[model samples]
Target: MNKTICSVPAKIMRNVVLLLTLLFLTGCWDRQELTEMGIVTGIALDMNKETGEYILTSQFLRPASQSTVAPTPNEPFILISATGKTIPELMQKTNRNVDRNGFYPHNKVIIMSEEVAKSGVLHLFENFQREQNIRSYAWLAVAKGTSARSLLEKHKTSISSIPASFLNNLFMDANADAVSSNLLNFYKKALKKGESPVIAVLSIDEGVEMTPQTTKLSGGAVFDGDRLAGFLNERETMAYNWVKTKIRNETLGSYDFLSEDGSIVALALIDKNAKINPNVSKGSLDSFSIEVNLLTELSEHQPMKEFNENADIIHYLDNIEKQAEKKMKADIRHLTETAQKELESDILGFGDRLYKRYPSVWNKVKDNWRAHFKDLEIEVEVNVKIKNSGLIKGTLLPESM
Candidate 1:
């Protein structure tokens, strides 16, 4: 036998290796170029009660065409919607109307109709995670008083070649300031037990038209498991963000700073952190304590009060801290009470905390934990640090010596 001779040809082996390397290195097998693909910016999910079907609406960035070169009387982007039993089914229906395949990798937002959210969003989201290639960081929101399809169809703004980019930027800003939860955070909270998930809610205000955009984030939606449990106003949403330790550089309204003058002052939250400590007593849950630490800088001052490091400043800060503490406590109390009584679902991830702190206990109590949660006592403590007083040491009011 010729031991030095190879059974297979070296040239064939080399070609195989080259082909394998190319296959692994470049994933261009199904890749499509920008010109060949349609970019989906936003998606809307609505439920049809009559037929128990889902209406999926998508906004696609329309490519430049000869007819659209000059200017169009209509919007730049095109809206397409389809109804089916499932998302994939809807996709098939959608493909019939559009020339290019709907690509979702760059999709910015997922809007759920209130009815759809109330009916159940878990299945829709499961599909999104399993079948769709949308980024985990995209924004998730609820559309108010209308079907998701309506929100998608009403487009009043125009962007240069990319209208969705503008909407994406708006959501990014909102999420950064703790105004809303991004998709990643929403999914994380939603999946966890003993905690409820929340998403920013978009609505169209007939009274005000800030932009040509048809939809705006008015408040936020609270979810118990996969169902829409309740809605939070903008202020409550801000407070919820603070409790979740997600606030950054957002203005928090001041309380009683004007000393009976009834003026309002606002401070920008520079940094904030919140910790939830759960304690078990007598083989049952005793209480959960939430400690919130906030560092803020003065953004707006009213009645021109002075803020020195002296007794006056200390007193003012003390009052401000008290106000903040009161507001935070109220917000937490409302959330807890509502989650326990009205929703009967945990959206706050208390179960995760329990599981982490006392896994053995949680294992025993996990089944009927909702009943126990309602009786669980909760304490909230807020510590606010006024890092900066802005340009002046205090306000310019004549009341201050």
Candidate 2:
């Protein structure tokens, strides 16, 4: 009985020690409350001519005070701009001015103005690369015709709780024709070899009366190495998407086909796939053969022609498929030819393909690939299948039929 009592006293002493330790470690030393930190939703980068410094703009979130009351006609975000030679210095200045410490972990978008991009985004990229606290996958785009700050100011009313959440949703819900851009991938391509960086384009457009302005995200900005080379239209971007981007997974591309009487038919592109083959002859790069195949459904047709029978319908579908194939082939050709002739750069990533598929040939030409790419020849073939006619099965009885 004496031994049992002694053991109980020892156990009680151990429990007391554990409780004291837990008490000591209860609160975090670097604890930060949600209300205390100003969450950054978006960032815009530009160049300041007068200051000869970088213009860094940040969009900070201001959540509603009461859940039931509608937020005062005030915007859900506050946009701030500070000019500094470097990002670190700019951020330090920003911290001193803002009411709360700015947090970037929740950032949604990064916009680089066309002028800033042309000058070289190396410094901006370095900061993003070095930062460990924030997401590396913020949706990156280049703003055309206006400042990045202007675009951010206009890109609102997304209906998400936080500004960051709104931008993330906006990008996710955006049309799939353009490939999404992120910091890491863009920089990796900019720093390394073989491929060029292409960023989605954002531009401000006039909205309805109440909204006043809106942002358009389409097309793309192409970089020859690290410098902004040229802009690609939507058609050109579609061609690039087929060869190098994620278009096949998400978008049902549309094409216009001219009818016999000068009218048009609209077909929706679907289930597309591509195969590229590189040929070499006599120890010199010969040519590249690209084959593209896709399925399409007819959405709208002109009133010019009426299909009289099943054979006529088949003929019409066949003709539509042929036109689509031709259009895709022409588009790919134009993109490659432009890459080779006008841009004089391999933005199509043929060098990387050559490196992978034909390492031996690449080893010989990798150093001078850009020069060779300009003069390189290519053969393209596109095959399209008309899947359906969308609801209208047969011809409307013309009363003559």
Candidate 3:
């Protein structure tokens, strides 16, 4: 009757619950700290021919030393290397030599030796995809005729304090086409039936020590399936960009040509759109047509005769537009021929366009898309308009030569 129930007190139960909660609050088991971990901002992969091993080069940031020092000529970042038979093994081996666990979330770029890329990057990607720390947006590039290790070496300042940031800046330049070589992006495109993958080409100037601006990211490395097929030069790259996207800033690199008036001239593209349309006839792949509209401004017009009147300006503009159109078409044609005949890869998303417009036709050629894309007839038409002529125009010949 005294209610001697065999029950625990509320106070004891509260204490038990608190102790269990405390056990679970031991923090993330795998969480790494910045000070205790090597903050990797860039990574490069290479293959050693003699040893037949995979080489991993990692760039670690030392911000504490950089800002606190007198800014001597020492590298702000430290590069470490390790070799293994595979990418995952290589990474594990590399970590053994490092003072701390190599953290990759901050990695801005991944450079691969040409040999590594040609052999196929699927294994490399496979390991990275499984890691939570790896970034999807980190750029991927192929080093031409050089070890990826050489590129990561601190030979010179590439403008940025760290080489990794410099690599990021090189690819992210506004004047550039704004395309990323991020592995995730490449993988997505590769999986698409009508699209192939392309990564940026990183070339270093061997003439002198590479300045921050010395490393060039002008062209692209095209891939067939998962293996690299070949490369596209700067001009062809520009053309490919045009065919693939609308101008973000409309600025193509400077163009110089001989004007119709027998004078040297130069122009800068400001903005435009490159549109591709695939036409099918009778449910079969027929042809692809491209229409581009461009707005250009005169950068330099060294006319033999001055623009003394508005009509002269009109005449010069017309001649320049025609010349520009011709050059543009030529570039596009060269790119098309190379992709079709030489590379035998569909760098252009033409197949994707075809699939969208003509799904039935796409199904027929989807398996052998590159073959059909190469054989598909294509036409291009470019229209350029000159809208500006600088702050003031004319020759400095004292008004009467």
The best candidate by lDDT is 3
How should the candidates be ordered by TM-score, best one leading?
3, 2, 1
lDDT of each: 0.71, 0.77, 0.78
TM-scores of the models, in the order given: 0.82, 0.87, 0.89
Q: State the TM-score for model 1.
A: 0.82
What TM-score number comes out for model 2?
0.87
Candidate rank order under lDDT = 3, 2, 1
Candidate 3 local distance difference test against the native: 0.78
- What's the true lDDT of residue 234 in model 2? 82
C-alpha lDDT (0 to 100) for residue 147 of candidate 2 = 86
What's the TM for model 3? 0.89
- CA-only RMSD, every prediction: 4.6, 3.8, 3.2
Kindly indicate the candidate among 1 and 2 with the higher TM-score: 2
Q: Number of backbone collisions per candidate, in order?
A: 14, 0, 4
Q: Is candidate 2 or candidate 3 better by lDDT?
A: 3
**Candidate 3 residue 205 C-alpha distance from true site, Å:** 1.3
Colliding residue pairs in candidate 3 = 158-212, 159-212, 250-270, 250-271
Tens-place lDDT per residue, model 3, 1-401, is 33445345666889999999999889898777767988899999998889877888999887665876465566678988988877678778878887788888889899999898888888778878887568788988889877787777654646567778877877776344334468788888876777778788887775646434356566788998788899887777778777775455437656666655577877787777778899877887778998888777888766445556787778767877898899888889988899999999888889988989888888898887766877879899999888886634456568655
Off by over 4 Å in 1: 1-28, 65-74, 153-163, 175-179, 208-214, 245-261, 306-311, 391-401
Candidate 1, lDDT over the whole model = 0.71
